[model samples]
Target: MAKREVRETSELRAIVDSCQTVRVGAVDEEGMFIVPMSFGYDWELDESGTPRLTLWLHSAGAGRKAAAFGANGNAGVDVAIEMDCEDGVITGPYACSYSFAYRSIMGTGRIYPIASGEDKVYGLTRIMEHMAPGAPQALGPGVLDRTAVWRIDVARFTGKQRQPKA
Candidate 1:
């Protein structure tokens, strides 16, 4: 089983853009909790002209997930795309002969709840654009009041790929 690490930013963005949901892992006094959430993101230059990847996620105003965020902001996120299993290629009759092909990105980041109404709308717009391209872009103020939008400032991330042997 040979695995390859993807180092190019283009490849990483490709994997992220291809996925609809991100699996976020958070921990609190109780324990660890992982939730699959819809998200939107953008790669832009910061004030110092350094490239940055910022992710936007949203959830109900109150929940276990939100509680985890309130208690602790640090989290681990994973996005996977292009997954498939290859079977019937085994020369010998064994389960180990099968292989899976996939591309994934995983990393740790800090999740901060957006407090400003304008920022919330911006985040929600990005999320809607990614999740539903043709959907309405505007988010009502009342809707923003009920929803909690979060921003994940990715610190460091790595991408990996597993290709089925020919």
Candidate 2:
């Protein structure tokens, strides 16, 4: 419901920035699959300073994810940051109260494999920075050759939070 929705752009960005991993959803010949993956992202700005979010991910050159991309480039992604939880509190005599507090962002986007060496390196660098800040920025050509980098240009997204009812 709207009461649970997070409408501020800054808040949504915070949720994304706080999370280290994203759940990527895609469909294949067999069926659908949702997998957790490490990711890096960039928030690009337009002339008016509006922000555009794009996610970067990496994987082996060949595999189920690669195959799924080949079949369908469309995908959905979710990033969640759990803030806290409450448990074992008896709200009623008959049952214990349980609730989780978390902030999350989810959206649909088109995934594409980055083919240009320079672009791939840039994306990979962002990924490394997010996963391991202060780590090496340089990625060897051999390593790049063995890795497949992908980008998701998010078209639409929404943020939501569930908190303990006051």
Candidate 3:
């Protein structure tokens, strides 16, 4: 498979940027890869290093995701966020498809379950922020207790982008 070039610093960060929600792919012991769900980028970068993606994952309390993770601790993940370009365009009819179609993102990271209480709380907060951009959302009481947070330390991330001429 060919790799895409990484440009525009913001593109690199934009993948996990203000945009929330990402699909996580995990492999099962049966050698089957299953997409757990659509998680969002909870936290960005901190004093530690590269932005570690924060996710609010939910299992049936137990299911494919849980089993897959158990089989292989080191999981493979892929995320793609697509924006609507020219919806519909035609010539004679009256419309012509024309819009910008660009995507900047990369996949490949190590999954490390949040351990520290503070970090977990921080990550959870970030998740909420991503979900509700500028909305005011306060934790009810102990919302953290029921939720599980996973942090993906971006090992290798690269993306490519192209826009319509001005």
Candidate 4:
């Protein structure tokens, strides 16, 4: 076993692209809250070569998620997200040696609502493109109004992998 510190931005992007779902975590009056749901993401390196990642998520306009993230409010709430692409099980002769192979990305950021109709459409389009490319991305009238679109501009992220032995 080796240390899990993935510093390469390309590798981190790959890990994110390989998965369709992300687990988002936040805290509210009740305590810690988390949910696993499908998502869409974008990643790029800025002019200074700093990595930038953005995630798009959608849910009902009102719920626990919205409450935890202050979706209906002006203030942004801190959140953590995680996604993983599982490879397979790594079998071993002994129990201690057994492990699963996977690549994962974990990040922290603030989540805010996409207030404008144009921005909501954009976020929904990205999600559709990532979840099912070539599918019709056009939104019907008032669809954006009924759905809650959220954006997460990942401040920092890291990737890790445990590859199976050859």
Who is ahead in lDDT, 1 or 3? 1
Per-residue lDDT of model 4, residues 1-166, tens digit only: 2487677777777888889999999988888988998888777889988889999999988888877776437668889999999999999999998999999988899899888988888889889989999999888888887899899989988888988779
Best by TM-score: 4
**160 in model 4: Cα distance from truth in Å?**
0.5
* Cα-based TM-score, every candidate: 0.80, 0.80, 0.62, 0.93
> Worst lDDT window (10 residues) for model 2?
79-88
User: What lDDT tens digits, residue by residue, belong to model 3 across residues 76-108?
Assistant: 343222221231332243345444445555466
Instruction: Tell me how candidate 2 scores on lDDT.
Output: 0.74
Q: Which candidate has the top score in lDDT?
A: 4
Q: What are the root-mean-square deviations of the candidates from the true structure over C-alphas? A: 4.8, 4.6, 5.6, 1.8
lDDT of 3: 0.51
- The better candidate by TM-score, 2 or 3, is 2
Worst 10 residues of 4 by lDDT: 66-75
Q: After TM-score superposition, what is the CA distance of residue 15 in candidate 2 from its true location, in Å?
A: 0.5
lDDT of 1 by residue, 1-166 (tens): 2257887677777777777888888776687777888988988766875557788999997978887775543343332212112222424368776656677777877788887988998899889988899987866658988998988887777778776456
